[model samples]
Structures are given as C-alpha cells and as structure tokens.
Target: MTEIHVRDLRTADPADAAAYAAVRRASVPAMPATAESVAYTCVHAHPDARYRALVAEADGEVVGTAQVGLAHDSPEPGQGYLNVYVHPERTGLGAGSLLVRTAEEFLTHEGATALYTWVLDTPRNRAFAARRGYRASRTAQFLRLDLARAALPPLADPPPGVELRTAADFRDDPRPLFALDAETAADEPSDVPAEFDDYAYWLTETWRHPLLNHELTTVAVVDGEPAAFTLAHTDGDGRYASGMTGTARAHRGRGLAKLAKNASLHRAREAGCTEAFTGNDTENGPMVAINRWFGYEVFDTEVRHVRAVG
Candidate 1:
C-alpha cells in the first residue's frame, strides 16, 4: 500500500529545503533549482503574497511538490497559479494527486477565481491537468544552447555615447533597472496581465533572488540611462538561464534587446556556463527569432492550463 502526506515547507530546516530542491530538480530538469533558491523564496516572499511551498512525501521520502500563490502583481484580480511537479521515479504513489488537491484547496480558500498552470507538453502531463479541470490555453517553448560550442554573436562596440555594463555595476543603485523592468514587464504577452508598480516588492523578490547572476546580466546604457537589459540566472552547476530580456519602449526596434542578450550569453560562456536555457511564448515572434539567431534549439514545450473557480 502506498501512503502520501503533504506539508508546508520548513524553511528553518536546511534539510527540508534541500529535499524539496532535489525533488524539483529531478522532476523538472529544464528549471534551475537549488536549496538556497528554495530557502530564499520561502524566507523572502512578500507579506501579501500568501505563498505556500508544499511537499508530498510517500513511503518516507518526498515524491512531489507544489508552489501555489496568488498572482499579486497582475492587474487583474483573483488570478492565481499552482505549479506541481512529481518525481519521475515516484509517479505511481499518489503524491502528485495529493499535492494538486492541497494546492487547489489553498488557492480556492484565498479567493482565487482562476488558476493557471504550465503542463509539460507530454501526453501524460497534459492528461493529468485535463482530468483536474484545466483547459489548455497557450504553449511556450523552452530552448537550450550548448554554450561551449555555440558561437555567440560578436559584441558590437556601443555607439559613441553608449556603454555596455553588467547588473553588478548598479549594485549601489538598482532602481534604474527596477524601473526598466517594470516598464517592460507591463507590456509582456501573457494570459494574466501584470502591473509592476511596486518597487519594494520587486526589490525583495527579484533583485535579491538567489540564482540571479549580477555579473553576467548585461545592461545597455545610453548616455548613462539604462535602456535595455538581459537578466541572467545560474544554478552553480554550469547551467545558465535567461530570466528576462527587454528594452525600454523608446529603445525598441534598435536591436537593443538582442544586443543585451548576446552580451550576456557571451559573458556566461566565458564564466564557464556550459548550457544556456530560455523560454518564450509561442506567439512572441521577435524573441523566438532572437534566440534562434543565437543558435538555441527548441528542446521542450509546455502548455498553459487554466481553470475557473468560484
């Protein structure tokens, strides 16, 4: 007989965080996971975020986990998300179901009217979400590039008054980056619209994120103004990911986004990152083209599943 139990994350226990990270890495190899990242998220969630990290244990070992929370940054109210991952080795133990149930109930109680999740495009994963009342919405592709072999675009010399810099250069004052992020994020294509008007929240959640690579994050500066940037994150294991890349509205159409990303990728490769990963909405043609130009190949895809709840 198989038994399963779901419980909240014990941030105080490093072992618990490590176990959660292990399960996540085993379940979703495309995503970067680390014990420090798990602990940082648990410890620094915004006061109003109402976040929960639940782990499902079967036969005395954690076999599944979920990160459930409201989309507090979205302009639309009552939007929530629940992403569940089950260890590939422990699938038949009922841990996945238990984790999903627990996560749904938590979101429902928090007044979420809609819940969105990303299910890997695999048949089994799609079926699991469908059976749970989620209808597929849109698909996104995950692309990976072998940094060691991929030839990155040459770094162009910044125009006379323009300069290239890393995120660390702004360590003493990151408000400029935060402002640029807010502007760009507000216009990103997504089912749930976000409004990043809260600087303090972004400071705590994004700027201080554990995996963010400040030195590898390339920023484009024009006349000392941050115009474009590519945020980089690393897992300390040779894997690097492009967390976000965007250019200010006025700076768009000038290849600034591409420039920043190329610079960041080159820096990551030089820093010994062997693999690079990034995701783009299927409809985001420009970004998809940019990644393709960088020699990234589509490796996996996930479809967003959404369900309505009272």
Candidate 2:
C-alpha cells in the first residue's frame, strides 16, 4: 500500500469533489452528502468562517476527508472545528491520523485556540480520539425513521390563529426565517457554540443550498407571524433529512415545532422518500422526546471531543 498523504481539496478538479463526497458518504451514511453539495460548500464557504476542506489520498485514491474551520460567529473567540472521517474500509492505514495532524497544524497556524470534533462512540474510535489528547465533552444521537414502514403521528389541523406553510412561500423574503433560525440555533447544545447573526451569510450558505427542499420544508405561522418551522433537505433520491426544527421562544410548549415537523414528514412520505434522519444532543430532552413521538429510533451515537491549542 502507498503512503497516505493529506492535502487541501482541489475544487477545480472534478474528481476531487466526488472523492471527497464518497469518503464522507461512506463514513456517515445517515448524513446528506453529494458531489454537488461538496463543491457548493467549498466555493460558498463563509469568508469569516475561514473554512478548509482536505482529502487524504493513498495509492492515488481518496481514503479520508476533513472539514476544518474557525467559528468566527461564535461569541467565544479562537474556536475551531475539525470533523474528520476515514473510509471504513481504509481505516488503520494512517489516513485518519494524517488528516487530524494536518488539520491541527493548519487550524493552529490560523490562530485557533481550541479545537473540537465529533468522534463515533465506538471503542476504537473513542480510543483514537483519547490517544490524540482530546477530552470527551458531550454526546449526540443520530436517529433514523423508515418513512415507508414506521408509523408517524397523524397530521392535524393547526390550532386557532395558526396556519401551515412551506418554506417556498417565503422565497421573496426569508429574513423572517433568518430571525427564527438564529434565535433557535443559539439555544442548541454544541461543543463549538454557533451564532447565526448574519442574514446575508445565512442566505448564501443555507437558503440557497441545493439539497434544501423549500416545497417540503414546513412552517407554522401563528397570528400572521412565523412561529415554528422544520427545515427539510432531500438528496433528490428516496432519502430525507431534517435540517432543523425549532419553535420561537414565545411559542414554545404549544407543540408548534412538532406540528411543523409532522407536516414536513408527511410531505416527505407523500413525495416517495423512504428514509428520514435527524440528530439531537443527548441533553436535549424536549427535542429527543419530540422525535420519539415521531417514531425516530436512535441508530448511532457520537461524542464531542476537544483539544486545546495555542
């Protein structure tokens, strides 16, 4: 076997995008990934985020990939993230270690003071992280629901003064969604805190994402205002994923979020989507319970790890 080398992704190279996507898809089957998504991410990365995508190659083949970047919007400064994934069939060939080492060197030189990553909770993966001086922080679970087989909550009419709409209805103006997403994202649990204060950034990075299905993303409006929403993404295939679901602070405890998610899921099922996926921080009891009510089952677990840098 040839030695593995980690290098920056070459977006100009067509094969690079596919290779990167292949590694990521093989490593995390539940996550949405595609060659187009990979290229879009590399080209439209937030300038303030200081993002970089790297691929590990061995024998002229891509075997691993990593996304390293600074969390510029984080209220805390010097926060960086390095989420690396090696092809399952190629593990133990040094691709993971090489990618992590290269990622650390790059981010640290970029002035990052703390680094964070999510490692699968398997014994081997956890050991690899610990050996690299990373300390476990929090856990999250990836849940999957067979849209074709699993029983979902019946769709019900919205309460008085409440109405349901799809994200497509706001194509002319998405600032209301920017406001709702920003507020809800802040309360989410994470190792590298995120703050979505820039609407323009959200537009370029999120609103225009190719995977986003505005026609299927459900929103619940109350009293003529956006109250809760469930953003949805599909791979144009039979697989669906919930990008996010949150209720405005003023509308919490009224089941608006669940209502929006249910509407979105029903739409996905009607559209022939066979599987649906979502992830939640283990500590988020409310959201976890809500997903359970929708019949999502925990399929995998990952623990966040942190390594302090200069």
Candidate 3:
C-alpha cells in the first residue's frame, strides 16, 4: 500500500524544495527553475495571494509537487491555477492524484470558479489532464537561442534623443517600468486577462524575484520616458531567459521593443550566458517575427487547459 502526504512548501525542508525544483526542471526543461527561485516564490508571494506548494511523499520519499495559486491580479476574480508534476522515476504511486485532489479542494474553498493549467504537448500529459476534466485551449511555444553559436542582430545606436538603460537604474523608483508593464500586460493575449496596475505586487513578485537579473534587463528610454523594456533572468550558469519584452502602445511602431531585447541579449552574452529561452503565444505574430529575427528557434510547445468549477 502507498501512503501519500500533501503539505505546504513553506514548512518543507530545503532539501525537499531542491528535489521539487529538480523534478520540475527535468519535466519541463523549457521553463527555468532553481531551488532559489522556488524558495523565492514561497517567501515573496503576495500576502493576499493564496499560494501553496504541495509535495507528495510516498511512505518515506518525496515524489511529486504542485504549485497552486489564485490569480489575484487579474481583472476577473475567482481565477486559480494548479500545476502538478510527478517525478519521472516515480509515476505510478498515486502521488499525482493525491496532489491534484488537495489542490482542487483548496482552490474550491477559496471561491475559485475556474482553473487553468499548462500541460506539455504529449499524449500522456494530455491524457492525464483530460482524465481530470481539463479541456484544451490555446497553446504557446517555447523558443531557445544558442547564443554561443547564433549570429545576433547587429547592435545599432539608439535613435536621436533615445537612451538605453538597465533595470538596475530604477531600483529606487520602478514606478515608470510598472506603468509600462501594466499597459503592455493589458494588451497580451491570454485566456484570463491580467491588470497589473498594482505596484506593490509587482515589486514583491516580479522585481524582487531571485532569477531576475536587473543589470541585464535593458530598457529603452525616449525623451526621458520609458518606451520599452526587456526583462532578463539568469541562473548564473550559462542559461539566460527573456522573462518579458514589451513596448508601450503609443511606441509600438518605432522598433524600440527589438532594440531593448537585442541590447539585453548582447549584455547577457557578455556576462557569460550561452543559452537563451523565451515563450510566446502562438498567435502573437509580431513577437514571433521579432524573435526569429534574433535567431531564436521553437524548441517546445505547451497547451493551456481550462476547467470550469462552480
């Protein structure tokens, strides 16, 4: 007989958290992961955000984990997410089911009316989600660039009266970047629309994230105003990720978005990062063209799944 336990991650030991991160990295290589990042998520989540990390242990060994949370920042309420991952070596011990059940109970109690999850584009993963009542939705692609070998776009000088800066420059006051983020996020394509007008939440969850590399996050400034930015993340081990790159609506046609991203990637390569990763919705044609211009190739895809719960 197998006995499984699901518990909050804040109470888990550091080794267990590390194991959880390892399983996630192995299961989804396109997504960035690290023990530090996991711990940061646990510690830095907003107080009002109902975030929980549940680990499944079979008798004496940890074998699975799930990240459950409410979409507190979305314009619509009662949106929640629960993503479950079981260790590849220990798949048949009922850990996944136990974790999913516990997560669903928590979300339901919190008044969640709908839940969204991203499942890898594989038959087994799709089948698993389908068995639990999740229906397929739009998909996104994860792209990677071999920075060590691929030729980057030639660096061009900033247009007259435009300047380039790193996110570190805004450490004292990130409100400008926050405004830009809020505007860009509102325009992003998603099943659940987000309204990132909250500055405190962005500071706690995004600006202070462990993997965020502020020094390499390039920003484009036109006439002393933030026009575009490319948020960068690095694992300090040759892997760099484009966390987000967006341009203010009024500044869309000026090529500032590409300028910011290219500047960030050059800086990342200079800092010893050899690989770059980014994700885009399949319908985001503009970003797809921009990434292709930067030599990024599609490596993997994951479909978003949604389930309605009354």
Query: Which candidate has the highest TM-score of all?
Result: 2
Q: What lDDT score is found at residue 18 in candidate 3? A: 82
**TM-score of each predicted structure versus truth:** 0.97, 0.98, 0.95
Candidate 1 overall Cα lDDT vs. reference?
A: 0.89
Off by over 4 Å in 1: none
Q: lDDT per residue, candidate 1, 1-310, as tens digits?
A: 8779999988898888999999988876768889899989978887566899999988778788899999888778899899998888888788888888899999999999999998889999999999999999999998999999997888787767668899999999999999999898887789998888888878888998999999999999988999999999999999999899998999888888888888888888889999999999999888988999999998889999999999
Q: Model 2 over residues 1-310: C-alpha lDDT tens digits? A: 5788888899888789988988987898788887888889989998877899999999889999999999888999889899999999999899999999998998899899999999988999999999999999999999999999988888899999999999999999999999999999998987667888889889988899988999999899988789999999898779899999998999999999999999899889999999999999999988999999998999889999999987
Provide the lowest-lDDT 10-residue window in model 3.
8-17
lDDT of 2: 0.91
By lDDT, the candidates rank as 2, 1, 3
Overall lDDT per candidate, in order of appearance: 0.89, 0.91, 0.88
On a 0 to 1 TM-score scale, where does candidate 3 land against the true structure?
A: 0.95
- Model with the higher TM-score, candidate 2 or 3: 2
Clashes of each: 0, 0, 0
